[model samples]
Target: MTFSIVARSADGRLHGVAVASKFLAAGALVPAAEAEVGAVATQAHVNLAYRSQGLALLRTGVAPADVVAGLTAADPGRDERQLGVVGSTGDGATWTGSFCHPWAGGQAGDGWAAQGNILVGPQVIDAMRDAWLDGSELPFPQRLLTALRAGDRAGGDRRGRQSAGLLVVRRRGGYAGTGDELVDLRVDDHPDPVTELGRLLDTHTMLFGKPDPATLYDLTGPLADEVAALLAAAGHPVGVAGLDGALASWAGVENLEERIVAGRLDPIVLEHLRRTAPPGRTGD
Candidate 1:
């Protein structure tokens, strides 16, 4: 009752899994990834250990097909399990057990795999494969999301949807550059889970995505004064000399310092100021 894609980004800098299923918290059950390692999605009987073990195997330089072989080698119920993997080297492979629900199958290539069981039809995986091919230049997270959307468009789980998720990992892509959960989002139970997951991904990007340096707005003149007033109204008053300090403190508190910078602001940052400034006051 699920469909998923496991993929490595075109640049080989990230790995991701996108999945949707007629199961609660499908996100928690089906997808896993680690930076510089690979990604996996195990469904159709759902072997949770396959996630960690699969990554470990990928990290060991095992080929994606070999990882799938090793995962099913010792399993008593391998006939009921479905798995997909994309290795660090960008090779990919998939397995759909013989006993999985009807319309079950999989397709894989050098950098991606698409698999599903109990799907509406073969079109589900076909659409996902086409979508992944079409989104080669998009951010990995966006590409994965787009693949999920395409699967849904072509008729996804025949049973219906309860949850959807996207998991992407990159070196030092986490908040504050501390870890690698570049994009991890889920809609555990939504009438339109894919759409909802996309919304969460967008919000995550806004809150944490780096702005282009070319678009940064230096805080000076009227912009600085207006920002200072907003800070004061928000309970962080500082005179002109300390305006820069005040903005710094506020940005730290909101976790937007990456885009806000010190004295320079991103257009997103300025828009934030407009949204947070007092009702009757507008930024100049």
Candidate 2:
């Protein structure tokens, strides 16, 4: 019926779950997480309590395996349920009930867990793990989605795809540094929900992502002149302080000021300006 991955980032600053199912609105029910606690995916029998209950247990400093044990023990329908959890420290655990459909089992290792039911062969689950292992270079949400795509390529939901959901939590990673719901994207129903989810993620990135220090562009000398000129052409003030102020305002509107240094610039922001400004505009 579904396949999913739950993981904590290698740096332990992020945790998330990506799930796709033949059912509609799978994301709303199958994935759950907290900023510094952990993440869990409960499917098969689909225990709704596992979402809040698991987080509560994780918040109490319990291990993921124990959390699974406690949750399952309290539910009489445990035999039909599937559960996966990843702790804040990157420890992971999974449980597949005996009554779950064929090809229904899971694997848990280190910082991630993969589980599915009523679908392809064991290879689907394996492909997800392999994808997660191979995606160290990607951001945590992207990596989780990559793993979901791998499972899909391996024949994800036997019944077919209808909906998919991704939920990621990071410290102060929400809109405007408010909460921790970093990326809560969902394709409630679609012909190809995975690809649709990707599209949404791209839009979210441009609006919310911060530039990495490894890719920063310090504004000084001739580069500053070029940027100032570009700003002016874009109808922003061209003075030194005014340019920075305008860029800051732009960044604020986009919710992308995290990568900005008050006095410097980020190359990614410049690239954004170049690409999104106008047809006749060009800047290096």
Write down the TM-score for model 2. Answer: 0.88
Off by over 4 Å in 2: 239-241, 252-259, 279-284
After superposition, candidate 1 runs with Cα above 4 Å error:
282-284
* Cα misplacement distance, residue 71 of candidate 1 (Å): 0.9
Compute each candidate's TM-score over C-alphas. Answer: 0.94, 0.88
Clashing pairs in 1: none
Compute the lDDT of residue 148 as modeled in candidate 1: 91
User: Model 1: how far is 281 from its true place, Å?
Assistant: 3.6
List, residue by residue over 1-284, the lDDT tens digit for candidate 1: 89999999877889999999888999989999999889999999999999999999988899999999999997888999999999888569999999999999999998999999999999999999999999988888999999999999898999888899999999999878999998888899998898899899988888889988899888898877887778887666776648778877777787677776767878887787668767754333
In candidate 1, how many Å is residue 245 off?
A: 2.3
lDDT (Cα) of model 2: 0.88
Least well predicted 10-residue stretch by lDDT in candidate 2: 275-284
